[model samples]
Target: MKNLIFSLPFFLTLFFGTHVNAQKISDGQTIEINGMSVTFNILNKESVEAGGKPYDRYKVSATVKNASDKGYNIRLSSYPQIVSNIGLVELNCINATGAKLTSKKIELKMKAQMINVSYSAYDKSGKFTTNMIPITGSYYFDPGDTISDNAIFIVPQGEKPDVSVRNLR
Candidate 1:
């Protein structure tokens, strides 16, 4: 009987341990996408005062892994926009100065998933850009590698909307 009681506590922890790491975020949530593991968390956002102007901004981080023994290419792209869900927008990147950079759109073939939009960057300039800035095709993760996503978003001027992000396994 003593052994049974002692084992009961251990059993509970094993049964519920997997769910303890799941998380969620707002319209612009930082999600980690790896094989058999995904996590979501709300991003910390703020505007930089440059030339006396405010640029709306927020950032989310993600890590991707190749996991396979061989060299593999991983492409990180946006999911779709949430539909009929007010006060929400999807953006791919933000610069160090807090200005949103325009980019080429990425289409995620998320098999009939509920996500609504995928936004990537379109770099028309041939100059090299890096750090706290939004640029497309600037970085890509490789085998046995992890990287930060740095997803960004802004509230439409003069209006605020409620949002919720669901973390899916």
Candidate 2:
């Protein structure tokens, strides 16, 4: 009884301590593509002060890992509206901003998937309400690499926006 009782504390400590000290997984979501691992996490968004106005914004970060030995040419949005595996990537433009962005349009050049999924959309609510909004910029990825980026979004004061990517084309 003494040995069993004494060992219980040590065993419990070992198991519980490891789990407690383990790395904190943001969003705890992962998606694989072309043998690459993509982990998605809700970024620690900050208040944005644009156009002489300060507003809170939402952003998501995606970490891609190229595990394959062969180098694959991949293009990803540093601020993809939706980090999904269905090739339905987008950039929320209701409150999105980036350096070198074109004043006319913001193209989401997601030229990675086999299908021709070129489009855009808007983000205005806290839910998944996708829109086809144009974007700008060109970014790509390669093999044996791990990269992460954030996408900014807007959640209007009272609207319940859709969180799912929409085929608003």
Candidate 3:
């Protein structure tokens, strides 16, 4: 009886204090990344060369348009950044016969806040080009990886920015 009395308050708090289905919060407004009033235009993607060989690695790219009056810096980390916030961004290239081809790794990069960041993907050649797909790995943008950054540009209020991924031999 004593133990029940002691635990009653705890149980009550747990049962009553929690919300069953609270609505998610939203700002309804977009914020500039890395102090740059730029907008991402393209999330381009393609197959990439892996380990100096033409493998079935899918390459991912993102393009941002500067909308700020001054030069705006941007980086991959400023966005979802690989397999982090958005989980693994995956692309698949499969063959008709259901046979696996082969794949390799490719570098990715973005520049923001005056800093450059890079990322990489693995090759899955045996999977086939038709099924050649790329996704987010368990890694984020790091230094010395393939990356792209647009020069500081004075974007007018209505201009758009762009970014993309390329498939290279």
Highest lDDT: give the candidate number.
2
- lDDT of candidate 2 at residue 18, scale 0 to 100: 39
After the best TM-score superposition of candidate 2, give how far the Cα of residue 29 lies from its true spot, in angstroms: 1.0
Model 1 Cα lDDT, one tens digit per residue, 66-112: 45454433233542223222111122221223345522111121212
RMSD for each of the candidates: 18.1, 18.0, 20.1
Model 2 lDDT at residue 122: 48
> Considering summed lDDT, which 10 consecutive residues are worst modelled in model 3?
87-96
132 in model 2: Cα distance from truth in Å?
42
Query: Where is model 1 poorest over a 10-residue stretch in terms of lDDT?
Result: 104-113
Q: Residue-pair clashes per candidate, as listed? A: 11, 21, 43
Better of 1 and 2 by lDDT: 2
Candidate 2 residue 72 C-alpha distance from true site, Å: 1.6
Q: Model 1 off-target regions past 4 Å? A: 1-40, 46-56, 73-142, 156-169
lDDT of each: 0.37, 0.44, 0.29
Error of 3 at 156 (Å): 42
Tens digits of per-residue lDDT for model 2, 27-61: 54565545556565556555655566554555565
Best by TM-score: 2
- Candidate 3 lDDT, tens digit per residue, 42-125? 233233343443322222222333343443122343344642231111111112111133222112223323333344444476
lDDT of 2 at 98: 40
